[model samples]
Target: MIDSPKPTSLKAVMETLNAQEAAKPSSGLTSKEKRARTVARLVLVQALYQMELTGTGVETVIREFSDHRFEGDLEGEKLADADEAFFGEGARAIVKEQATIDRLITDRLAAGWRIERLDTTVRAILRSGAWELKFRPDVAVEVVINEYVEIARAFYGETEARFVNGALDGIAKDTRG
Candidate 1:
C-alpha cells in the first residue's frame, strides 16, 4: 500500500498542485516531469468527473484521451512522457474495472439512495477510493477513504464526506469479498 502522505489539509494539496502549475521551466523539476505531473493530476480529476457524469467504460475514455486529446496539450518534442505513462496506466486500470467498483459501492449504500443518484462529487470520490483500493491496495484502505473524504470535504462539504465514507467502506468490503 502506498503510504498515504501524512494527513495534510486539502488546501495544502491544492496549493501544492497550484505551485507545481505555476513553477517556471527553469525550476528544479525538468519541464517534462512537471508537465507529466500536471497531466496526471488533470487526467485523474477528469476520470473521476467523467465516471460520475457518464458511467462510461474507463478504457474507452482513456484511449480516446491518450490517442487524440493528450497530444494537443503539448507543444514541442518535450512532452510529459512520465506523467502520460503513469496517468494512462492508472486511469485505464480504474476505468476498466469501474463497473466492479461501482457494484461494490452500490452494495454499501444506505437505504433509499442508489449509486447513480448520488451527487457528482460523492461519486467522484468513490471512484478515486475504489481505484486506490483495487489497484493500490498497498496503501491502506483507511488512508484512501480518508484522503478522498478530505477531498470531498474540501470541494463539497460534510454531507458529501459522509456519503464518500459510506461508499468507500462499501467498496472496501466488496473488493475484499
Candidate 2:
C-alpha cells in the first residue's frame, strides 16, 4: 500500500520544480519505459490542471505526485507506474515555458477561438501536448498528438479529442516541420 503525501499548496509544486534540475526523456526506451512515459504524460496533464485550478506552484505539485500519486494507484484506480523524472521535468518545463507554449497554442487556435476560452482541462491537455511537440524531439510528433488526444478522450468525448488532435496537429506541423 502506498502512503499519501501531505498536500502542499500547488504553488509550492511549481516553485519546487522551478528550482530543480532540468528533466528530459531519453530515446531507445523499453516497452516498460514507453508505458511509463505514457503514464507521465497523463499525470502531467492532471498536474497542470491542478496547478491552473489552484494556482499551485509547479514544484509542490510534482512533489505531491511523486510522493503520493506515482504509486500505481490513484483514488482506488490502478495506474501504470509513471516516469517520475519525466513527469517532474515536463511539469517544470511546461510551467516555465507556459507563456511561449500558450502563444504556440493561441497561434494554432482557429480565429476568434482564444485558448483561454477553451475548457481548463482541454487547455491543460493542449499545453502538455504542445510542450512535447516543441521540446521533446526524442518523441515523435504523431505519438505526442495521439497520446494527448487519448488523454482528452479520457476526460471528454470524441469532440474534445478531435479538437485536441487538430490543435496539436497544427502545433506539430509548425514545430516539427
Candidate 3:
C-alpha cells in the first residue's frame, strides 16, 4: 500500500482519489472528463509506440484507434472511453512537431543517453510529455509531470517513473518557465 493519510484497500482508493479530485476547485473539468483525458494520454502513448514500430502514418493510426481501439479494454484493464478528439489532435500535433519535440527531449536526456537509446515505451512517454509541455499551455507543469509519471509507473517501476519525472521536469523548466 502507498503512503497516505489512511491505509486504504484498492477499492476504497478509487473513492479516495475521487474525493480528492472533487476538492480541487480550480479545475473546470468534471471528474469523468478528466478520467477520459487520462485514458486518452495512455492510449496516445500506445499509438505513438505503434506508429514508431510499424511505420504507420499518423492519420491511419488515429483512425484505426478511433474506429477499433478506444472503447475496449487495455492490457486487461477496463478503460474509460478516451477523448478521441484530444487523442487525434495530440497525435497529429506531436507528429507534425516531432522534430522539435525530439530535440527538446534529446536535450533533457543525460549526456550519453540519446533519445533513440531510450526504451521505445520510454521514448513515447517522453515525446508525448514533451509535446504537452511545449504545446499545451492550459495544463499545469505539475499535472503533466504527474500524469506522465503515472503512465510510466503503469509500464515500469519507480526508477523509470523517476527518470520520466526528471526528464519532463527539465523539459517543463525550459518550455514552461
Candidate 2 is scored at a TM of 0.81
lDDT of 1: 0.60
Q: What is the C-alpha lDDT of each candidate?
A: 0.60, 0.75, 0.77
Candidate 3: give its CA RMSD in angstroms: 6.5
Per-residue lDDT of model 1, residues 17-91, tens digit only: 446346533445565555455445444655657754676666766676667656653223222343666666667
Task: Tell me the alpha-carbon RMSD of every candidate.
Answer: 9.2, 9.6, 6.5
Arranged by TM-score with the best first, the candidates are 3, 2, 1
Number of clashing pairs per prediction, in order = 4, 14, 0
Residue 51 CA error for candidate 1 (Å)? 5.9
For lDDT, candidate 1 versus 2, the one ahead is 2
Candidate 1 residue pairs that clash: 1-138, 1-139, 2-139, 58-95
Q: TM-score for each prediction? A: 0.58, 0.81, 0.86
User: On a 0 to 100 scale, what is the lDDT of residue 29 in model 1?
Assistant: 53
The candidates, ranked best first by lDDT, are 3, 2, 1
Worst 10 residues of 3 by lDDT: 1-10
| lDDT per residue as tens, model 2, 24-81 | 3344666566666766876888888888878779999988887777765544333446
- Model 1 Cα RMSD, 1 decimal: 9.2
Over 4 Å off in model 2, which ranges?
A: 1-27, 75-80
Which one is best on lDDT? 3
